[model samples]
Target: MKVNYDAQNDVLKISLSSTPVRNCDFDKPGVVLGYGSDGSLVDLEIREASRKIDNPRSVDLAMNGRSVHGVRLL
Candidate 1:
């Protein structure tokens, strides 16, 4: 998995897989979902990310109920 934020565009992209996207759908305003040919979720895109998230350039990740990583600033 990979997360990237384009501050210039205020857009955030989260890539869940490397699969080729077959189609894209707008799940809601300013949000898009990409699906693979097999109908599995491939990635997600959020427009106007700065307004949606508290801090669009930073992220906190956790796994197995533990803070396994430090915050990352894009």
Candidate 2:
């Protein structure tokens, strides 16, 4: 997994390399938006810190202002 942020273009690119992505619908890629105290980006956030372990049912994620743990299989 890899994450890159381009401050100049205000673009964020997220990718997964070690594992193949499944059940994902990608449309040429885009941006995500979030509001904050300073301001907000009305674009996209390619949150890269998300992954599945053991099986595709469970995932670990980190994004925005929080960290997630032990996501169960669904």
- Cα lDDT for residue 41, candidate 2: 27
Candidate 1 residue lDDT tens string, 1-74: 98999999999999999999999998599999999999999999999999999888888888888774447655
TM-score of 2: 0.28
Model 2 scores worst on lDDT over the 10 consecutive residues at 48-57
- Report how far off residue 2 is in candidate 1 (Å): 0.3
Q: Model 2: per-residue lDDT, tens digit, 1-74?
A: 55454444544444434333333334544434433333432233543323311333344678896889666532
lDDT (Cα, 0-100) at 66 in candidate 1: 79
Best prediction by lDDT: 1
Q: Which ten residues in a row have the lowest lDDT in candidate 1?
A: 65-74
Error in Å for residue 14 of model 1: 0.6
Instruction: Please give each candidate's TM-score.
Output: 0.89, 0.28
